[model samples]
Target chain A: MYQNPRAMPSAFQPVPALAIPQGDREGALLVAYANGDPEAAREIMAALAPRVLAQALRMLADRAEAEDVTQDAFLRLWRIAPEWRQGEAKVSTWLHRVTANLCTDRLRRRRRSVGLDEVAEPEDPAPSVAARMQGEARLRALSDALAQLPERQAQAVSLRHLEGLSNPEIAAVMEIGVEAVESLTARGKRALAALLRGRKAELGYDED
Target chain B: MTRIETGADGGRELDDLLAEARALEVVPSAALWARLAADAERERPRPRTVVPAVPPAPGGWRGWLRLLGGWPAVGGFVAATLAGIWIGAAPPTGVSSVLPSLWGEDVSVALGVDEDPLSLLEG
Candidate 1:
């Protein structure tokens, strides 16, 4: 018999992982596009758009602008497909770098007009309505905590933690030394924990 | 609920919190994909034109020779002129008959050897 130490209660089941396709598909499409196939470019853009947009949304905190940044990133990818050298870096990472740069620029431009408190919480009102409701408060608290960090710290934390990139990979994307990346993420995590500690109840961390 | 000691220390708690936060998923709108596709299509560089091959000239051999020699017609003219000049040059008389008497006259002028250079070739 299996010893289930942390079995989910009847009221609470774990959510399944999101099905994001592998990067190989996008790489193939990019190669096809380089070989003068426009349809391949379209396919790659369609596949990558969502992930790029999500990262942008997390970084910029404005859905509309995130969408714009995502589009711009894909556009650059399409234009550069012909010049793309294989085995240099993953296409996804390149796209991430482009999105990050655009978000950074947008953040700089909006610094005067917007405050960190104004970043709207990300929402998805599907699946179990109860889960959706539970996610809102946690998301808001986390977003606020994320907003409070310095720009580089926020970016390092976002790329490493949220985006699930390795520290070295993040360092490459951020064009920084790995040691600097570690320092940023370490500091960013400390700041995040302090920010989120008060809201532990809402985030399901303090539940019995 | 049994609280298992993960031994992650205080930093572990923060890591766990960050992990949970990262697990939150937000799928981008379908419209965003459509817009991205459109933008990609627009930004994609047009395929470069495949240049058609230039057909070799009507006289293939002549064309090849012309290409090989850079200036085929000029090369041909110079070659023909050299050939004509070589053909017009007079052939030499028999070496023995021409050079033996010349050698005898040179010996009489100076105390040279009696046997001529051309006479050495005779049997």
Candidate 2:
């Protein structure tokens, strides 16, 4: 659905979001929410959900599971609005942490029944439409490899390489030091290379 | 059999894979948004609905009396009460004669240790 960012009514008028840069959008939306602009919630829901949902999908490897994690994370952002100490942390970093923690919780629960099973192979049969997308195959392979990495390493890799978060931002989301974030991502990248090396030929990595 | 390209080795190939993942955008379905909107509405504290205090419509006797303010009305009220007490406590001869009947003869007897009606007559 096309949500006209302005079509969403606001309880109080806000400075328009037209000039908001990518990094500052969530913060702007949050400030609007705190100031009682109703539209801010909708804008935040639209802007952040896709990113959060995508991250959750990568972390959890299930669409339903990812969507649940996204919902919970946004619900929490709403709940914490009044006391959201602005500038203490970027809203995106804070949300990434929440979604990560939630995914970790579900991962733990699923682990009770699922032992050492490789999580990368897509459980769903490739629909003809999706099968045409080579990127989807690469993502599936990468996700399976990620599942094999240690939890923190997987998270570090997802945040750094996949999510494109900087090391410091990854540290904030993982609640660890920047050095640790660096170490984890480095280790994760090495591990992924070793895993994917054997499959590159099969997955058409050199179609050219 | 196909081989994935890396600038150098496997590490470069993984980097290319990571780039694909980064560029990948997964927009959530509208139903998910609807669910969130419902939860947001359910969870949002209702706006306090401040019943705008109709500014008391400018005085029913007591308010006008209050707006008239401190000294004049309040002081007059206090002074009148004090005067009434003083008159009741110690009335002059002619005033005392009429007051006893207004108060009833029992009030003089009731004044007891605080007053002696006979002593006032001597004054």
TM-score of chain A of 1: 0.66
Q: Which candidate comes out best when scored by TM-score?
A: 2
Model 2 lDDT tens row, B75-106:
88899999989887887798978866887676
Model 2 over residues A167-194: C-alpha lDDT tens digits?
A: 8778888888999987887787787688
DockQ of each: 0.17, 0.24
Cα misplacement distance, residue B33 of candidate 2 (Å): 1.6
Off by over 4 Å in 1: A1-28, A60-62, A107-111, A116-134, A197-208, B1-17, B50-123
Question: lDDT of each structure?
Answer: 0.65, 0.72
lDDT of 1 by residue, A12-98 (tens): 212211222365556656766666666565555545666887787766545688888887887788778778876677788888888
Assess the local accuracy of residue A143 in candidate 1 as a C-alpha lDDT between 0 and 100: 52
Worst 10 residues of 2 chain A by lDDT: A115-124
- Each model's TM-score? 0.56, 0.64
Candidate 1 lDDT over residue span B12-89, tens digit each: 545665555556555666676567656765665656676757655556777776556557677887899887676557
User: Each candidate: RMSD to true structure?
Assistant: 14.2, 10.0
- How far residue B12's Cα lies from its native spot in candidate 1, in Å, is 7.4
